[model samples]
Target chain A: MNITSYTARAPQLVQALEALAQRADNQDSASTLFHELSGITVLVAKKFTNDRTADGMHDAFHLTVGCISLGISQAGIADSNEAKLSFLLQHGAEYVFQMGFRHIKELSALPYAAYVSDFDNDAFIQQRNLKAIFLEICNADPVSVWTGDAVYQNELLDRKRNRKIIDCAKWLRKNNSNGLVKDSELDANAAISIAVIFAVSGDGCIVARTGQRELENLIARARETRPDVEVNWNDFLKKIPPEFQPILRERMEELRGTIVKKIFSKTKIKTVLTELQDHYAGSEQDIDYS
Target chain B: MSENINLPAIRQQVTELVLAGSPEHAEDAINETAEKFGDLAVVEVLNTLEPHVASLHLSAFDGGKMSLATLLIPPKAWAESLAYFAATWDEDWIEDEPEVLAESLFAHIHGVVFGTDDEERRAELLNEALATDWGTTAFAVLFSTAAEEIIEIANDIHNLGAHRSGRTTSDHDVIPLVLEIARTNEEAWDRVLFEIFPDWKPGENELHTRSEDDGDDHEDEEEREHEYAIGRTTKELLLRLRKQVPSKSSGPAKTGGRPSLGEDIFS
Candidate 1:
């Protein structure tokens, strides 16, 4: 009926949802629990809209509940892999914050003269702090919260680590043909696939050495934030479409062959033209040239 | 029994009567002359006064063959008087059969009492009568009395019409007078009187008798004063509820970690 009534009711509802979430967390069925929690959050939102209070505390409470509910829902949907779920939770948190900000903007325009004045800024600050805590939890050590044992053994990690180095070396050899590749787009494209390989290797150094501007930037950012963090890059890369791997490998090989041949020829320009002609000639015989 | 007065014929006669008399004594003389036709059916009085009266008129239908004397008075009164006569008097005095008496009573009142030119006003009166909490018996008596009055007026005016030159009076001159009387009484008395007593058209004096009361207007003003307050309270309640509800995200950030990068690259 009024703001006081709504405020009084909100906590009890939130507590119920939290209890359900806790059960879900313990049971490792957060997804089902998250849906139930979302339903409760939606009810709270509907009641908040029905009551139409412009106070910031009221708005913040509803927003915070909605955000956390959404974050948990997203986390529930994510792969069991801690890294991926962390990513999803991060995105969900961002989305919730944006939603809350929009609500704040709308609340500011309420026709009641005292609406904005009655807002509780402290409550909003507390909500912000809670969000920071959530993000910290998401970014924390995956092993600490990870429920399952590591799927990638050291043998696979070593093999992936070696394969990544060889792939990077091959890409570097192809791109540097004629002494320099010069074209940033071509170099970056080659470097990206190579970086994925390094990511799969669990060796951040390969990413560091790729020398592609974007790859370098990623490495720097990752190091600064989480230098010692051991990311199973191969597991991360497994999330990518399987079809992309073959295409990436084929392109890298083709580029490497052309660059190596171009570098060896006495007449760099003439050799490139001859190689291009030969490649096209072979394609024409196999392909319909009409 | 007095001669049966046809309404048109009576109207012609009353016109002549009114034309021959001074306006001051015309109303009284018309009333006196109409009373003389008390032995005639109420329609006779109505028909006789048609010329002198502008708005009111009446008609009648046959009610089989009753003793002609029994049909002369207003049908309602005539029916009661006949019933009294049949109960008290011997069968030899009842020349007409009981069926004939019933038919005569029905015909006299059905055609003469209810019939009038002002159908709208009559309908309004009927609606008012139906809405009132009067008992069925009381309502029936009132309806019969009103009908009888109309028939008597019609006959009286018909009888009085004999004195005038045949010229129809304007209905505007009579309608307001009847309406004024009808407005004052809760029952349909004015309609009944107009139908039975056509010579008497309402004058300025009758219209002046009614007064207006201001109590309803004051109540309306009070309701208007609180209307805004109620509206404001409703909005306030809704506003408070809205504040309690959760808010949604506005839009994706232009630059953010994974999502923005993914969106930009993919989209």
Candidate 2:
């Protein structure tokens, strides 16, 4: 829902950087320029920030790094270090506003240190995040796990699996928000139609196939959004299992529209669930699409 | 200055913070140690913390990877006057505790590869990891992302991965780079096979080498099945990789001109 505009305030920072580059011959000026550049980055970042005027400083700093990171990526096609540096020198400023604006939205996203305020370690934050996911799977209170801080060793919740669980949890959270879960509950003999499926099969024994295909679709599917890069589509398609071919092609087609210029963000996990609704449209499969 | 500061108390405090899963606080205490008592005191504290840091239980459900890595770094690092893991975190600087260091390094590498859009930096970070003493572990962890629930190894080479894992997703450029490293680095490829299949002795029959835990005495049926189900397809995939980049022990005296694993899976 947030919109971005950078047409007015980015010129001065651009001029300052251009001036610094002109004086690139001076060794003593590097430190002074470093200070000046950082100050400008923060200043320019604050100018672009919308809400969170208080944490503007933190958001500004991360926004700057994210800005530079995005620029370096946009310019990655350059063959040499000198070329990339030159590319950054000439065009990086133009990108600063756009990329910075894009990244500021993700300031509250995972892996950024700015938002993981209470936890001192990034590792702890990921654990807490995944635990949020585990709680989601059980439909338990998200804050309940930390109630006693009682530590239990769970080897199944490793990083690889945790990512899937987290993605599925995000979908479940959205479903909860959209009243989909409540809507499903209004009918008799109807189960919720989330990608997450756990059935008793009425026996203590196992009665289902592995969730790998659905899990891969639900979890790791979002990470597949690298369409900006020059990927060989056919070769990429060949690597996946045959069952997933249609879903991937459909996802790729969606990526084309959702991906912004050089930056990819619509890559977040949501599309496949919507897309797979058709793939499973009216078969004898007990899967719900309610 | 040194005599006034109690080094043991500082060590106990820092180590406890780390083991108890508060590496951020441990890092703060480490900074305070460096500030009040200076670099020599920092070294002494890390020396005390080394083996204990190695013993840090890391996983998603246990102590976090970066948190554990943040603590383990100052102790395991071969650096001089360490300000801590910054750019040099994955820059191949482990003098010892390579196994322990690799756990954290891989976490950082995954963060970069999956987090950022910079292809060049991603390759550089991963390459730095592969060049380290834990290169083989790097290769294995990348190939099969040494599950976040990294368990304590048993009768193994004190290493990573316990559960069965796979997925040849070429969604990003990182996997291609990892395969490229495995294809080219012969020594690592050999150890990579061993790293994935802890029981397989390179040239030996992989299934024969595997110790199947039938779980006859196991009370928890799920854990029993999990134990039995570990690495079934991983062993199969290792064989496929072996066919491409044959290990020195596996390739009929490891033909000198053996081809690298082709770009079929990668490109």
Recovered fraction of real interface contacts per model: 0.00, 0.00
Local accuracy of candidate 1 as per-residue lDDT tens digits, A1-290: 56343222222223333444444344533443344334433433443333244453344345445444323333334323344334434444334334333333332222211111233345775455344333222221211222011211222344444444444434543543234322222222334444343443344333312323333343344444443222444443354445445544554455444533342334444544344335422211112222
Candidate RMSDs in order:
32.1, 32.8
The global C-alpha lDDT for each of the candidates, from Candidate 1 onward, is 0.34, 0.37
lDDT of 1: 0.34
Summarize candidate 1's per-residue lDDT along B1-267 as a digit string, tens digits: 334534445445544444454332433333444565543333454323322131111111233422222223233322222212112223432233433433333353333224434555344333443333221122222223233332333333444532331223433222332333234343444444332223344441111100125436876645544331111111222222223222322322233233322111101
Worst window of 10 by summed lDDT in candidate 1 chain A: A143-152
lDDT of 2: 0.37
Error of 2 at B111 (Å): 6.6
Task: Give the per-residue lDDT of model 2 (tens digit) for A83-172.
Answer: 544544444333433443333222213332111123524676644554343222222121222211011113222332333333433333
DockQ, every prediction: 0.01, 0.01
